[model samples]
Target: MDLSCSDQSDHPSRRRALAVATGLAAGALLPPAAATPSAAAPATGPAGAAAASYTNPVIWQDFADLDVIRVGDTYYASASTMHYSPGAPVLRSYDLVNWEIAGHSVPVLDFGAKYDLNGARGYVRGIWASSLAYRPSNRTFYWLGQIDFARTYIYTATAVEGPWNRLTTLSTPYYDAGLLVDTDDTLYVAYGNTTIHVAQLSPDGRTQVRTQQVFTTPSSVGTLEGSRFYKINGQYYIFLTRPANGQYILKSSSGPFGPYTMRQVLLDLPGPIPGGGVPHQGGLVRTQNGAWYYLAFVDAYPGGRVPALAPVSWTSDGWPVVQLVNGAWGTSYPSPAVPPPPRQVTPMTGVDTFDGTTLSPRWEWNHNPDNTKWSAGNGLTLRTATVTDDLYGARNTLTHRIQGPTSTATVQLDHSAMRDGDRAGLALLRDSSAWIGLKRDGGVTRVVMVSGLTMDGNWNTTGTGTDLASAPVSGSRIWLRANADIRPGGPRPGRFSYSTDGITFTRLGPDFSLGNDWRFFMGYRFALFNHATRALGGAVRVTRFELSTP
Candidate 1:
């Protein structure tokens, strides 16, 4: 796997350079002709009006490690969720630009006891990188993910939004694997980090029949991973990313397991934000109109890696090139010619009423949640458990991704059911976490603000916590909100605030700096947690969660 550069020692210098470059590019490329339109604007075309156009980052929220496939006129994308379960999120789009969460490949990542919050931890372990493919032979969808130390798992579903079956797990680890089902119905897997390998899978796509060394990236290529295998026009192409050189494509006319030739398809593309890295680790897809486009992600920290869309053109020699504006990555492009359907294009971020029987698809558990410890009736009820003192160990910590530029998340919590030693509140969860919530102590409930920072090596859990602020609360029901300003500036700080009436909010604690801890390998997320520091049998009822951005 290509580990993120969030915590690297040279991150400061690299980030400064990236920021300058990105600003210049955006100023130069983005104009009236290439406008970055609002996502709320309807993407519609009258009977024969111009196709609706959209800006880059088709999906604004953190939809990282992207792999996209177009079947007929519909487009489906699958991304890496790391340890966040309901892991492998699959998003569907009528227009390649607008997408909504169709479903997830698995409801819970139940690979081992660690994933279930037993003895060990799966913080940076579960579901590293994933590949999603649709096989025309059986009309089945296949999803593959690397479980780090464990085997590579294969999941299949008849429908994209599944009822997926975990068909089998292979003993051999296919690091950052890419699945390709050929025209002849032969299954192939291409994977590796420094050294790339190709193998033939069984007809059932379960076992590896044969393996061969295809190509190894030169030592000069800093880190090469995230492989997307394709057979276009009878030629085999494998898309891989090198941190220093951006994304490259390996071409082979010989076979799937090839002595391939490589070319840099996307090179030195400007990062989406200032202080961000280049965009990479995504696949390509074609529209019904015979146009091609590449979908990739930029390493935007404190908000996770977000996806970017770019138009693609094939040269006369049969190589695909990402279109660049002003000699850099383009931020806005014309929408595909395909007419978008009448369906509404929903943003990934929205309010969760907690009125439904099941959690919204927008919400994901910190790990595989303890199902028995949670329920949804009139609201979301989370029973306190004796996990570790840290929020990392506490299960049933429901989280949603924080949006970019600026966003705010507010949740109304009913702590009346909470017992002594019960702490229930809203948290900004990442490798480092902070929360403002109600803590019941000595028969008194107080509004307390706590912040935890993880040291360099101790990313699996919170290193230490400090009490930032506290105040006495007379009522059991309280509202907690986090305002995040992640736009290009100095440090991206999240302001924590509390409210009793839900209309007026009072700020709590100092500005909380959102750190990009490499262990979590994700952006800061809004988390709802209820845990017991002393004893169990405590509970919190969350009635509403509202998210807003501007």
Candidate 2:
């Protein structure tokens, strides 16, 4: 990691100018290219490519309470968790333009018996909107993730994926705290929920010396929670969630923590809905093109809210404001279109006979993961481990990541050659509380659904009780089709189905809306599942996985 903040001139040749002119342009951070007609096209490649920019939020899957920060050559972000383990899930990006879940903060926050987060049992015990900061001098990253008032701990690591050191454990009533370091290397820890407060940290980046300063009079600006402060030029801008009403910002000078004043509201609302308003938490990243942009989450009503990015411009008065029109807000800007999706298609190997030695990233898990639950041998063998009561326990679960709305992943599972209680199928999981998947029980292939905020099986079926072998031999190949379909009311509910053969799929269950707008849940996520209740290890063979847009 280079500590040298070289002069902008050294990197001038590679940096492009903003093609479109704007008042708050960061200057030379964006490319000088003009906005192309394809600017409206949806993004398909890694983050940062102009082709990935959208007039609206492109990756709309529910990733709630998001806090993003740039760390060295990568941008790291995390959000609230309903099922993801290790407390908070962390995402990394190279140019702040592209982002991927590198891992989690405190990778394996091995709580063991200290916390038991069963479906309904452990609702929100996990961490929420956590703030990220990078200490360049030591090349260490700091994260302050709070799991409500019960416990609030800070951790640090040299690399995102690391042997993180758990630091001070303070009983402060602060929840959702953000960490910031200034040009002078001074550290400030700030939190906002009911009130906004900042405390100075010891020079070593550990321990608080002075009492927290109540920076702002607690103002209910709607979804105002994820507070982040950034310095542009000389002015310090305080950004926080405005809840459902939209995000708002405050400005200050003199120092990082400040006697800041309200500048401008960053987001407005669409007419009125059943819910009063919908706001989201987001962070700002300055592109190399010299454009200052803000990325935040927006509640798309009952459809659930996900992360979105918009441009932030400054007014003539030096006040920062979110661009708006007719009192409504959106995610567009007069700028060069994002580039096209990358042409490289690094396809997964077609050989998935799972000799029990290999696992693809396409395979996922619910809640937390236990490496011992499965093994790759001569074939893919999944053995059930000790879990509390339901599937979320350390055992009996296999999962995968959600590719896209129009994508499909097909796998060949030969259950006929297996034993009972050994279920191998596909699923889309968010947390332990809810998930819908397909499992082969004995000779009957069934669609297993779990919802209602508990790990209870509210839905399940057994191929009409008839022998599945009697039907057309769809072969051992199973197709897991996941796609979004807009109903008559405009709600784009994501549907998951499976086929014995890749050609014809049987609609396994009713449509489950993709987003998690429902209170007390993180955004939506899709994953594959392979679990077993067998005494001896059983093998589920998958021949291949083909992912493609419809």
Candidate 3:
């Protein structure tokens, strides 16, 4: 809805941060300890909008598993897209509440052939809970994530909107890792599941030096991950999430490798939104002014996991706590500072004309694509990349993050090029999906609405959707629309509509209720796809996509 100074004497981490930027004293691996915890400045902010107070789930779309940082006055956040191509989405904001799609740290999820959807595998896999870091000495941004739980992939770029290059892949996986560039310009990765491990990396941060278990979960904490490492108040801290359990912090006064003590800071949230589930597993950031904040995710099902920002206050004991309002997570908080109106980039929701040489960074393929099969020159031309029974096996199915509460996706489609046995449409997707579009059979074309489609336990679409409704339609140009009420509870309604002249519309089919199944982690999406039920070479063009909210 809406949207700091440094104190070196206030917190040693501030001095260590400067050292991390300029390089610290070579010999000291750690900052000196104080009898009391180091201090940090209190927060100062306004919301992302003109309201002067920011709303929770700030960028209310599925920007999940975030790791955020501040570079100068701007904040950069990298998030997981799971099996989506361009795996890690990088979001930028002058004011944290009003974020923009900066670019992607990962150009493609090429960790394996399966990621290409070559074998109908890689669903609910690929990138997860990535760690994003910035090294001031080299002025580069780093993205690291465990892929398939087999290897950790690292990427580097000079800018947030990258021409990102894969630096290297470490054979050792760092699960839910937190990438930290320390005082001496040293790199360390704090990661793991229940048993946490801190790994030291090479000077450039590409290679692993060594890894050792730093902390083990207690019996009270069943499982723990999403480790975000920080040096604050001269203490090495690892902030962790026990998912539905609560948020916890591990403080090590000794050093990065520690004899550490743990504490559960908050639990059982009356989340930012009603029925928005729990907000968990995110990273923390310190504004240029030295104020601290935590950006976490709310499993707002049907809409997916959306980001929620909350302020952090340091306890006199040096611990950072998520400030609560009325004994619950507040719905609105003071936003970080920003320059006046008119942002340089487009906001998250808007109209996209498919006239660019490449698709906008906001669009991502369902998986690693067959790049040869698609182009964006004169509207999106998706030449059937896969000939399959269902959309799940279809490659190059383009998608955009669907918005929250309620939203509509409208697209102008040119379907004249569709050949026999071709299906081209607009869809609301997740484990269970639905769509409305054109299906060509023989020499006849029909406007069709399909629903009750679902994927198997292993993510394979057993078959195409049931035909809920169909009408004979003429002409090549048609407008397809989908409306969703993704407000985190029952009757998460998803519906389809169509128009012949882009004015008068007819609702189609029964409402396809968006499901809240936890097995399929990622939430509903707005999708554009064309696939062959028989053979390939058939294509369709999408002239424009307008994403709107009401």
Candidate 4:
């Protein structure tokens, strides 16, 4: 591989001007473009679009905690799903700017009965960081993810979009793991946070044969994790993220288990951005034209951490440097050298009609859903299960990511079949969540807006909201909507409203300021929830769920 370096000077005033022009705050690297909520519309095209240039946070939506790999010009990205069923979402991209959900590594995370909605739960616990690798020798795709802090499993498939096979589950849990297939076809896994380790896998890639400590970061580094191991040009490289110090790269010419040399490739340089956090925990890929670029994420909430693309230039001494403009990461750079295919970029946020035989790829259950209690036929039907009053603990709460800067989501619910003590509606899901929906109490149907806090430390709602808004309703059908204004450098807040006509919406609850709680470690998502407060036999059907951003 040929690596070249070029030096370009940047001016501070010009950098600030560029940030303002791109709708990003002076210190914030990439902020969501201010949008006006409207009806669901067609996706315009690829984000960061220009005739010759594109912007950072290439992916405007939330596909956080990502790892990307390239095989023959096509790039595949895998992201953390964390308790969401059909976990470990894999996406495919051509230009590294536009992406679409290709598939998921697992159909359902049934590591134990808890993931299956049993007595126990896996909230904030399912699949974390995963490594997606391809082995050319036998033409197989492999995915490794840690579960329950005790098990790490390897899944394999002959194709990227697959009917994957669970090859084996390793007894040792490797946190934030990275998988590498060396030039000799030997397999290695690098993992851990404070002290990183490299371990060789058995010939079958099932168990660990031998392990050794390769490198350790200082306490000053501050939460180093997400190790990505790669072998290029006979040299071994490991990429690690230190949110306080930026991203670090370790290189070893000796071997995979290395006495490596470490360098801070990208630093949290001084900048004027609003939400200032380092770019870290991503993968690197050499483009079709031999140009290298790093795919990483920045801590931008309440939209959650979003991906960013930056150019990489290698020095004559074989060290890679993450390029910056005027002491900060560039907001816009030239597009990659390869030409993207003739396809319209699909919007990750949109409407789901529930008319199809299966659920849309955009939807994911809070956990492994009880399939017997849910179906997509005339409309999306969710049967109430025995659970607490909180939406977090309730099973079959279908969810979708909240779009950035500004957006609105609306859902039409048919509660004709709802039983007494049944609650169903639209919600903004997080550690602290709020909803506006229909509730049946004392044989009376009413429209209510409620908020709850996860006080037990397990995401189970303790009790009903302190401020409850309720009004009697005469019908079995209702419309609920949530408007989220999550622009950076401002209060990230959301509001809930209800409508009987679906045209005019009445605000029901106070504006809820979204929280960036570290426990969930995810963006606030819009969810459709139906749960039983007393007994089971309650159900709701959703006819239309529309998401729009201006």
Q: For this target, which candidate reaches the highest lDDT against the unseen true structure?
A: 3
Candidate 1 overall lDDT versus native: 0.72
The digit string of per-residue lDDT tens for model 1 on 1-550 reads 1111001111222222221000000000011111212222233432335554667666657776677777766778777776789988888887777778888887788888878766666775576567777777788888877675458888899997678889889998787677777767788888776588887989998898998889988866555666777777677777776643377778899988788998877667775556666767777776555566677776667776677787777777778777777776677777677755666656677777788788767888988888889998688999986545777788889988887768999998888888887878888887777888887889999898888746344345537477889989987789999988755334889899989999999998999888753334667888999999888898999988889986
Q: Once superposed on the true structure, which residue ranges of model 3 sit more than 4 Å away at CA?
A: 1-50, 338-345
Residue 407 of model 1 has an lDDT of: 92
For all predictions, the C-alpha RMSD in Å is 6.6, 9.7, 7.5, 9.1
What are the TM-scores, per candidate, against the unseen true structure?
0.90, 0.72, 0.91, 0.88
lDDT of 2 at 251: 68
Candidate 3 local Cα displacement, residue 274, angstroms: 0.9
**Residue 376 CA error for candidate 4 (Å)?**
0.8
Predicted candidate 4 versus true structure: per-residue lDDT over 1-550, tens digit per residue: 1110000001121111111000000000111111211111122235433446667777755665677766665677777777788887777877777787877888789798888666767776676777887776787878887786688888888876677889999888777778887766788888776688888899899889998998887766654566778766566777776543366778899998898988887765532225634556677766655566777766666766667777777775567777787777788766776654556556677777798788866788888888889889678989997556766667888988877768999998898899888888888887777888888988899888887654455555565554468878878778899988765557877888888888898989788888754445567888898999999998889999999998
**lDDT scores of the candidates, listed in order:** 0.72, 0.47, 0.76, 0.70
Pairs of residues clashing in candidate 4: 26-272, 26-273, 27-272, 27-273, 27-274, 28-273, 28-274
User: How many residue pairs clash in model 1?
Assistant: 1
If ranked by TM-score, best first, what sequence of candidates would result? Answer: 3, 1, 4, 2
- Minimal lDDT window, size 10, model 4: 19-28
Minimum summed lDDT over a 10-residue window in model 3 is located at 1-10
Q: For model 2, where is the 10-residue window of minimal lDDT? A: 1-10
Cα RMSD, model 1? 6.6
